[model samples]
Target: MTYSLLNLAFLVPAAVLALVATLRVPHRRRFLRGLGLTLLVVLVLTAIFDNVMIGIGLVAYEREHLSGVFIGIAPIEDFSYAVFAAVVLPSLWSLLRPSRRRPRAHA
Candidate 1:
């Protein structure tokens, strides 16, 4: 399979987890706002760093397996990892972590 297909396979589950978190977690507006900002920052950083890494020969992809879409030298398929960082992991953290507002346990 192509890199884009691999990215899609990973991204679909992460997107579902993020969606579930949006529904079940508290402070929906804040979560969305933070998600947007985080996505923006992470994507930009990923673009810059990925381009640099590729330029310097620190990273490489086979042309046959790539989607042929790029931001500079970085493959577009590379950005799904940034989405996972900006969205899925945070959603999982929020979903899995105990709430700060939980009532103190009775003695």
Candidate 2:
């Protein structure tokens, strides 16, 4: 399969995990805010590093698998990995966190 198809296969599961995590976890607003911030940081870092790697011939993508889009030398499709990490990691963390219990009041 082409790289683009492989990316799509992974992305669909990552998106679903993020959605289920947001719905099931507590503090939805905070989780969303954190996710947004994470996405922004990941996007910036991926753009810088991926472009630099491609520029120096340390990395490359097969043109046939790409959608003919570019952000500098990095293929636009490359950003999907960073985005998947940002969403999936935090969602998994939230899902796996230990639950907190409230103290009982004395009568």
What's model 2's overall lDDT?
Answer: 0.92
Measured with C-alpha atoms, the lDDT of residue 1 in candidate 2 is 64
Cα lDDT of model 1 by residue, 7-104, tens digit: 88888998999899999977999988888998999999999999999999998898999989889989998898898778887898889998788788
Instruction: Please report the candidate that would top lDDT against the real structure.
Output: 2
Per-model TM-score on C-alpha atoms? 0.90, 0.91
* Model 1 error, position 4 (Å): 0.6
User: Clashes per prediction?
Assistant: 0, 0
